[model samples]
Target: MAAALSLLLWAGAPAAAQRIVLPTGEYMDTTSLRNPGCGAPFYQYYQVKGKYPVASATLARQAQAFLQQRNGRYTGTGLITFRFGIDCEGKRLPWTKVLQTDAAYRPTHFAPALVEALYAYLQTLTDWRRASGPNREPANYLTLLSFRIQDGKVVAVTP
Candidate 1:
């Protein structure tokens, strides 16, 4: 069997940051995976709006493809990571919450590529919005994507 590794990342406060590692750099986070269910991700049901029809699995595949094309070693055996926050510019931003993965995966090196692809896809979804639960007051927010292992280890992240 192919060994795997995954990681997650938080945007600010290096002190608050954490990291997870996996072998072959292609590992899965067994937990926190949103299943490809009867409908789109819960976010889609709410403020997130778009005419372009796509599924969660397709989104995952797209992210994996983007990773592979960038020479990333992910073999698709991992849970995803996420983040929801605005930049210094205060633009509504939803992204893959990046994890420190491994020594080779550094913010200065691979972060931009991964984030760029994710943002590009997100931009395609119009009026992207999110709410914590159905029937509750909807909060205008950006959603961040992330993944984690049962033991709290990060699998893969996009920031």
Candidate 2:
């Protein structure tokens, strides 16, 4: 009877298992769900709360600024892939680095810049799991971005 009651209470708890209690008494949990595309594009900033010291908006702005400043005066297209991980404790776990580099001779040199900017943006989100890899960096909150470049610009990006 005691075990049954305990189980019931546990099940009744919130869906977020690792709720981060903030200084303002707010709690944050990393939940996995797809972002339903509304009128605008989906960004990690809209999804996380108290998951990182920096806000998601700030990160996005930084990434955009970086790209806007760097993507100019370049041409061609390339692909960039990155991987990182997060755990139930909201801590970024160790993973592999899945960085793919294509030389300018193959396509263009703008691939790495787009990737770095995407990662800079990801540095601001919370509650994500990157696939386990051999050379991945460790963090409490993980962010992964895969960018598709076209015409010397990033045409599409995905988590």
The residue-by-residue lDDT of candidate 2 on 1-159, one tens digit each, is 434222221111132233222232211223333222211221232133213454445544555566686554435466554444344334442231334334342432343344445544454445443222223322133455555556555555553
| TM-score (C-alpha, index-matched) for candidate 1 | 0.32
Candidate 1 overall Cα lDDT vs. reference? Answer: 0.35
Off by over 4 Å in 2: 1-66, 69-75, 93-96, 101-112, 127-144
Model 2 residue 138 lDDT score: 23
Q: Candidates' TM-scores? A: 0.32, 0.37
Q: Which ten contiguous residues of candidate 2 have the minimum total lDDT? A: 4-13
CA lDDT, every model vs. true structure = 0.35, 0.39
Query: After superposing candidate 1, which stretches have Cα over 4 Å from the reference?
Result: 1-53, 75-80, 86-91, 94-127, 130-139, 147-159
